[model samples]
Target: MVLGRGNFSRSVAFRWIVSYAVILLIPVALSVIVYSQTREIVEYEIKRASVAMLKQVKYIVDGELRQTENLAAQLTVHPDVRHFLDLKAETGASAYHIYRTEQQLKKMLAANDFLKDIYIYSNALDSVLSGETYASARMFYEMKNQTGTFAYEDWRELMIADHAGQYVQLPVKNKEKKENTPSYIRSFPAQAGSGAAGTLLIPLNAEKIKTMLENIDWVKKGQVFIVDPNGQILFQNSENVEALSATYRKWIGRGTSTFTDTFQGKKSMITIESSDTSGWSYVSVFPVDVFWERARAVRTLNVLGLALCIGIGGLLIYYFARKNYDPVKELVNVFSLRQRQGTSRDLDEYTYIRRNVLETIRERDDMKNRHVRQLRVLQSYYLSRLMKGQTDRNVPLAEAAMTHHLSWTSDRFAVLLFYIDSDEGGTTDLPLSQFIVSNIVKDSVEGRHAIDFTDVDGTLGAVVNVAPGRADCWKDEIEDALAQAYEFITARYKLRFTTVGSDLQTGLDGVHQAFLQALEAQEYRMVLGEDALIWYGNVKPSEGSYFFTVNDEMILLNLLKADEFEKAKGMIDQIVQRAFQRQTPLEMAKCVLLDVATTLIKSIPGPEQAGVAWEEWRPLKRLLSCATKAEFHQELHDIFDKVCGVLRSRQTAHAGAGIGDQVAEFVKENYRDPNLSVSMIGDRFRLTPQYVSRLFREQIGQGLHDFISQTRVEAAKALLQTGASIDDTAARVGFASGHAFIRVFKKYVGITPGKYKALQ
Candidate 1:
């Protein structure tokens, strides 16, 4: 058994090592190449995503700042504030009209949610009103006494002296004098370039600025601090004020606008800049650790993928080395020409041949599967085009069938839809039951017709072609064939089944219409349970309207008012049913729903109390496009409730207009005029007759005619007291004649004009 050293050197083990080394090296090199390329791509993608997010955040911050500036500009232009400033400058009035100005400022501030407070600081009067109309003067006196001998005269002197130059610097002292603050003073320039000789100081809202910064989506959380131009810590997010103050001092005097620094040993990215308007520098510190934490997960995924590739490559080398050596052993046994033995060697050879044969078969199967998939795709594309009434000139029906590997030589065809209920849910993998059903349909109609099957939305459609003229006469036979197929599938495959057959028609053009009818018949599965065959022409037209009634409208309105959206949806469904029952077309019902919704929406008040106009409700149409029927109903209810609220507000305003009192005064003054009427009174007041009528009806519960006649008749009775003739009295109080006046008098006073005069 001893072999030479040279022969052993050329043995299978040596070759195996060479093969393993080559095989292993290939994947190692590939893994390194993949890792390097992937790392670069990941880094670039992260940087790109981060830059995009930062730009979005910057845009949001800039928008908010611009809004704040615009608001300030608006406040500066206020007429009341302007008048107060002017009055204070001319009269040096500390107390005069200060209460009125403060009240106006308070109301203005209260209207906006963003405003914390608004104050008018009068440089001339040397007084401050913190948007309060009625704070006691005694409190101000006490504050002045407590703040180290402060007085209005000292403040006035400071303002006048400050405005005498281009710029002024003064100490800002709080009312409690806990800390001294710096104030940069500048003269308020007049609108026409003429200088207004008054000092102005705007105290920045540090908290509000911090809030604006925090609202930025990309601003990293935790310990956000801002610094003013003079290196003061104006705001801090952290509760530990002392730590925040310490952190601010370390970077406050730094000349750089942006730089990275460490806070409590954690790396932070800080951005600092002076505001263009206030010259206040804002610093934002975002910790790098937070950013790195997000990157960690991505890094782990990349590393794991690389490691997996390397491990698989190593396993492949080990597998190849072990398997390749076994072939060498078999070769040695064959060369030796050993004595007769068991069939082990033969079995190994047979196994190898079988494996090779199976691999070849598998490759062929894969090719066939790919070909079938391509055919299905073409069929689906053509079917969609056919349904939409489009034709392809390049591919005729016969050529299309050939291209998709389908048989189309039959003279006539009928499309059959087979619905199978299986355990599999959703549009993922097709179920085995579907394949069985297809086979059953093929078997049942064997030799009688040629059939092609396709899957659509979890159901199988079989296009069966029979001889021309045979389909119409054999329609019952065609249905029986499909029914038998369906029953067999349900029993054999243990699956529920539904079959819908189209009318017997010829060619692909007929197939489209047949497919449509087949689909329509399938809808009957809702009423008739599975395992049944439905013919196209046998299906009836769906009865009833798809809309609700007036009672449903009331129910929906009440539900919406109470904010019960779920119950409102149920009622909307009922309404849809009732509408369908009333023969209301689907399109008309939808339009009615849209109108109800839009009317409700238009009734809502505008965001700024400007009141919503009909044009603003136009957006409701776009909202309607995406809304479901139930959702549309709820939206309509919401709009109506808002409109009702606006109406209530308007009604209250009208009632408070003193319409009843005004009408009484008007009637009293005009009662003796011959031509006086409600219409004349309405014209005098510049009001519509209908509006006046409504007012009278609501307030007095009487028509305008009744009120006018009562007043005129009473006036006639009073004139009679002066011993005037009935005709003269009637003529004086807006009556045409004694007889006409007598008729009205009797109607009202239960007596004729002369009788009323006799009673007097």
Candidate 2:
């Protein structure tokens, strides 16, 4: 009995030890679980809030950038700036003109302190005129000539290569000036042709950007970076902080909005927000320990409470453990239910933890998938902005490539615009045919390229990323792929396609230029005709002026004046044909057509006398509003036909030599009168002096005033040769004075009247 009691007492002691250990362990496990779970939740909230706040910062910064871009564009197209840029100085322009241009630039700069300085490099003047100084273009060139430090030539090449809108240069401090100001430069006439004028530099104050970033509370203890699209670091919060670490940069490059990674030798939460307007990214980084502080305090309290409960009472320890465990079990049950429904009764505590862990994994995967989808949408948005020349320069092309899941044959990119010409190719669905074609093209050229096809404006635009050392070889491959796609689409859906591909450009930086070239190539159909794959290189811009000259208009006027309606119509057709074929500037063509319309309106012989209200048919507004060349041609034809109709109706009212005959008759009849000039004759015929002069010249083979002088000199010569006195001859010839008569007589006869008389 004594041995059994001793064994029972030992067993009871062992059970009590085990029970006490379990009771003590519960609070610790609960504290750890609570701490871990709370840390995760807090970290998540911080990341979300940080990312949201960065997005707001992006919006504000993007607005500022857009405002800057607008200011640049506004200054570029400003009438005063353009006028100054277009002024050509043979040697040097007048001081007043230069001073006037300088004053205007000063006013523009004075209006905004945000702009450091606004300078216009005028190729015409061979000068760089700005608020600071009026200097030669060579001086401006030398100012940027830091050779190895900054490749001024490379930036110049980039600016010249781009003609889309504005070519942007990332900030770089000028070593010569000893100032750390980061300049934002924009080249005018964005898609600068060979006749590119110059660039406009707006060196921004770094402090302004720094102040803006400093005002944001999210990045108090953390770091923030303003990065360029090319992956260049524009501005950073901490100068001591090294370049972006590969681990953190990897997440950023992949375009992950919020990610956790080790940075600066500690775990950090990174949040990145990119601007659609400027193609810049705002990065905010905070240490992981920031959110863990609250959880750590709770952990410390739990540890002290457990230590206190150890000596206080076993009942107290049990109550505390049960209280903490209840919430833990409830939390576990919530996740466990999501993993496997209606199995809570059979599941142990370990099973609950496992189920919860598995559920979190599944949720993470779902979130990843959604993030991937969002990334693709962002990629599309990025490309569209590139096409529109609105891409932010703060995001690296490599990062873009990662985010967009792009793989290219070469670094060079070319934009191909595929236009669907069929009216009923894809049933009632407008995008069906485009979708079919895009897919086929993508599938056909798989592995050799990276391409994205989306509707740009109304046409299907395909941006093809290709690697081409020799353009001809690449053209063949591109043509083969395009031909295959065209043939397949045409055979399958009976849809016709006209594809225009731009020249290969260096990188994504040139996408806008490539897109613009593709658009320009599309216009070549006006010259090259339709149904061919038009390459931008093949459609070399036809150089020289496309403006309608005096000779061209005079030929048309002659045909109209002769009542040759058919010929006049043919002439109109020829003029428009030349304009279309030459690919004349739309504005220039509109202006030429307007000129033709005005000429036609003026050609109507006495519209007032013919009872025709010609002013009612004011075609200037309609001509000015024309958006397309076709519309211009149609408007031109309408004006021509209307004007010709009016002329045909009034043909009998004013026949051959109508106004010319009357003007010449009046000039001859009143040639002796000293004041009988073209203006006097014009007054008699109710015609403009300019028109009277032109009419008299066409009919009489000399100007009316010249004929009058010739007649006066002829009369004086006859009087002088016939032994008439110089004074009598001068008076009879209607000379205002004797000296005036001698000057005119000597000019025509190569001798004074007195000298001529002595010779006779």
Candidate 3:
């Protein structure tokens, strides 16, 4: 049945469903057909490519095997090698000479990249020469003592057992031989007058051969193995290959031609067969999936291409349907004009505002320019007073301003300067509108009073010279009035404010000093809050010492002892906050804290126990560079915690070595000597006697002499080696007299010296 558009259109839902199903099925059916054909082509191509690559690999591998065989053959014919074997046959030859010859062979083998190991076996000589000679005679004797019959099978068995088939054996002979016949195993009898008499068995370098195989570019990424004619794998790269399988073992002996076989338990498409020249079979494995993977990619591409074509056809139909409609052009033209007009209006308003603001600012700036020279004079006078250490007092503003030819005799005022933190966005190029605001506030305040206000430095400050007695009264009134004005101004125009109130001062002399005090007061706001009004009188003089409470000290001590860095940091922050509240000089406070921390770290344990080298500890210079007190405290806390952690670990590791115990043991063992001293004990332990003596005195609460003397007198009575009278024994045990020893002995031993000796 043919489905017409009119009939399908009438039933829209059914029509779309059927159309979509047909559209989807068309690509799917075509994809199935194309996938089958393309898969076949890709599989054929992959197989062809793999075969070509295997051929190339075989060519390279075969060439390497031939070269190795040639090298082995040369060793058999070498005159030095032949002479060594002949000498080895005689029992009179020294082993050292044979060892020297082996070393020479090793050097030659090392120079050749293709040789893994080279060994010569002489049946008549009854000796085997490995590539390298042993330096020790005992080692040489052990190598030369191996006993076995001169047969290739013995060599093969030894190699296979030793290395587990990671090595290949190559036996090169001038003639072929029958199995089980020793006569056929004989070497090429010294040609006429020549003297070569040994068969050489060399172990092939499997990795080198594999590398050569890899250079072929088509060998695929897997193992290439070589096997002997005895159905044994002579060499393999991986241990995963099952050596017990008869089929795997038989593949090696299957003649000198290429064919496919499974290897290493995988269904590998391996090219296996023997080399006609070497009789060693090599297997180059090209996995089956290498071909199948190519087929999969081709199938995917064919389906994707068919779908792309269908999608393009649908897009073309949509494009033609849209082209038949109209009126997008006219609407676009109308909107374009409106966008242009809006842009022009924006530019016009921006330019007009910018011009007006710039012109008004310039006029205000020009009028304020007359005060710049006066401000410079005022700055010089203030700086002079600062240099002379009169910072707390004020510079007289009227006297300084009059010196620069400005009349301020009738004006009465107070100076106020405001600072605003820049926006959270970042520093913008807004040239000090806060300065303009300060001027506006100053003008408003002056307008309320009969006073004159002058800009100090561009937006940095303003100077107001008020009447002498009125300075203190107007300071508060003006500050409160201006603060309200500032709050209004900043709210009206988005900005931030920080105000510094100068101390009361008169005229031009104190004006400059007052301006400086105002500047100093602003610095206090960092520790104080934002938008803060800091006054000169409110600034406390720093005592230069932080009063940490007993609890705080214990917290710090526990942090250091337990190696808790975060807790230490928090404690330090609290300390710094208290210190800053007291107005400690930031630098001096930082130095004091760092010094305390360094002392605490050093006092934790000996440097070795601490595990921190003296050089690793943070330097005082680095601590001092911290701009804020809290930062310095944190750095100190971190260093102390690290030092303590190292100390705790070291203490845990060497809990046994207590100096007090060591001293007790020393005194107990050596108390018989009257001349014994702390110096002798110190030398034995590699410590200064002064240090040891101090430790002993502290722990025992007595001098080392009193302890040693008391113990020695008691030991003397027990010593039969001092076969003398009790008085002589007492004298020998560091006593002035026998009576004194008897007195001390009775005190410690609960008996007189003579009676103690009689009991012994």
Candidate 4:
């Protein structure tokens, strides 16, 4: 778990997420700090702005009130107003004075919007005049019906009598929808002892003032309302006017106050400023969020913006991280050629990758060395076969060289032969002696490029490359190198060496002839009073007129397979004896006998059939160890006896039990016939089809049908190697059609017949 976590933590995605998250978090942190720090500053700024607006409204009210008061003063001092007040009797002159004073009042009221109406009354004349009408009685409107500017009681005290020292009024309840206008009334000219003539009264247009306040859009969005000291709403463009006025009045104690109040979770800033001239207060309460609603909007935008950034950044990081890791994934796939196993969970990626890299490098090196060694072995074997006149017609020498990556630096060649003659204290083992002499000869002839082989018994041979037109130039140097080899062998192994250099030859056939000629010269080399040959043919010394043909080998193997031990023994004896008859230089004689021994050993059915493994009999090694001709012949006799004895035992064991052995051989012989089936075999063997199928399965370890198909497929493979056409091969191998041949061949060989032929 710890390792898994460590690998995860080190991953590119994890690091990318961390990096991008840190970048995105910077804005989030800054927004939080900025939002937290700006609350008070916003409230203070809003309070100042609202207060300034309130002061401006207060000034407008005061100016209007001052203008009305100036008009009232002008009315008191006017000559026409004095003339009308001085008269007491009703006459034309009094009527003329009344008309003049009424004209003055109408003109004054027309010039100012703040004045609703201007009225003057005198008790001596028992009349009242206003902009709209003239009243003959001192109090034109009755007290019970009075509702325009004042009550009758207030009219009696101020206009009819001089009783005013201080007057205070509150908003009066009215039956009409429009609020009642307040009037500024004052008794005039009574201070100069002229007696109280009349009073000038001016009513204010409260709706006009309210309309002016409504035009301000900024304050209208929140709480902007006018309130008197009694907490009554006067002019407002907002909802819940009474409640909001009361809320502000409850917190405000004096002319102006800036304070904070919170209800529920919503906190607000209340700014209230009282107007001295109007005896009213302008109040506005703003929610804290509203005070900085712009800042709030900015904060909201930042949050949404941050969320979008995080989303985009996450995608970008994932894309870039996966793109970066793609190469690593490819490397993993390359190294892990098979599917991933559960065992890999114990290792981290880096460690697993490192191990796979090292293992792959080692495997590549091993395969390269093994391939080079296999190619060298093939080249050496091919050259040896060519020397003994066993070259394949299908495989040209140039093609073989190209296929094996062999480079031939020279066109000329010659055979250099070394004979290992065993001393009294030297080794008698044929293979060991050949091996030692081969290594010694290769090392001593250091500068020359040679293809060396230790195939024949007791002889080490090399086909050394010779420069063209300088074939004789190599003889003296080769003799000197042979002297060195002879010295080295005598000192180390108690062995004597003899050398023979064949005449220089040209081309590939010339090289093969050179080796044969060198074999021919070995006798002369020994004849020159040199060391005796340690090993010759099993029967005798070489007599050149000897050969073992393919017919000779097939008959020998068939005899053993048929359990004809005596015939096979006779065949082996005749072949060895003929191969040794008057041997020329021990080349063909040794080559023929060894070839027959190897073929018989390879054809020993299987380990179970003969009760003989390669390790058990080791026929080739034992035969090569024979000290005399008779000993060599006895070893061959023994090997053939064991192989034939094993086949004979199986035949005898099955003879009483079943015809499995006979059935297996019959299938092998008649498999080329496409109609040959289990029923045909039963008819031929005089048995039932079911019994024949069971016997074939029990003996061959496969169904009778599959065994015949496989047998034909095997033969088809040999035919394909000899460069036959696919359709011809299918017909020759008893496959019904080309398609069936391809399908069945692929079933057995994992590739189509055409593909297999191409590979060959």
Model 4, range 1-760, lDDT digits (tens) per residue? 1235556876545666678778877877886687676766676687787777777777777788778777777777788887777776555346676777788888887899876667677766666777767776533654212656666665557566652221224233334343445567677665346567666666666667877777764567566666666676656765454464344457546568877786334676677777666566777766767667676776788678768877887788677777776676666656567534553655544566787667769989999999888876886676677666677645654575576565555667777666657889999887788778778877876566544553643356677775445455676666666778778888899888666666777666776787777776555453232542211222224434436777777887776655556677788888766654433444565667777887677566675634473667877788776544456677787877677666656654654344677777888998888888888997797555765677677766789888888889999999999999889999998878889888999999999988888887
Return whichever of 1 and 3 wins on TM-score. Answer: 1
| TM-score-based ranking | 2, 4, 1, 3
lDDT of each: 0.59, 0.70, 0.57, 0.68
Tell me model 2's lDDT, rounded to 2 decimals: 0.70
- Which tens-of-lDDT digit does each residue in 445-498 have in candidate 2? 765666887678878887787754544476687788888888878777877878
- The stretch of ten residues in a row with the least summed lDDT in candidate 2 is 1-10
Better of 1 and 2 by lDDT: 2
Task: Tell me how candidate 4 scores on lDDT.
Answer: 0.68
Q: How many residue pairs clash in each candidate?
A: 15, 14, 19, 7
lDDT of 3 by residue, 1-760 (tens): 1225554443333434456557766877877787768756754665566556655655765676666656655665677676766663346556776777688788877877766556665544555667764223233223432233335445534422322112233343313421111111124345446444555555555566556655656544566566666656655555565663676565555554444556655555655655665565666566666667767777778778877867775675455434532243233334444342233322222243344457669989987887786675665455444323455534354554455454455334345566655545533334556445655675666644443333444334555655445654776667766777677666665666677777766444455667667777766666565666777776746555445445556666666654455666676666556555535654555545664565556546674534453556644656666665446656766666666677556544653346767787888886656556888887776555665676677766777767787678556765634557877777666666778677877887787767666666
Which runs of model 2 end up more than 4 angstroms from their true locations? 1-36, 110-114, 144-147, 151-163, 170-185, 190-194, 245-248, 298-760
Query: Against the true structure, candidate 1 has what lDDT?
Result: 0.59
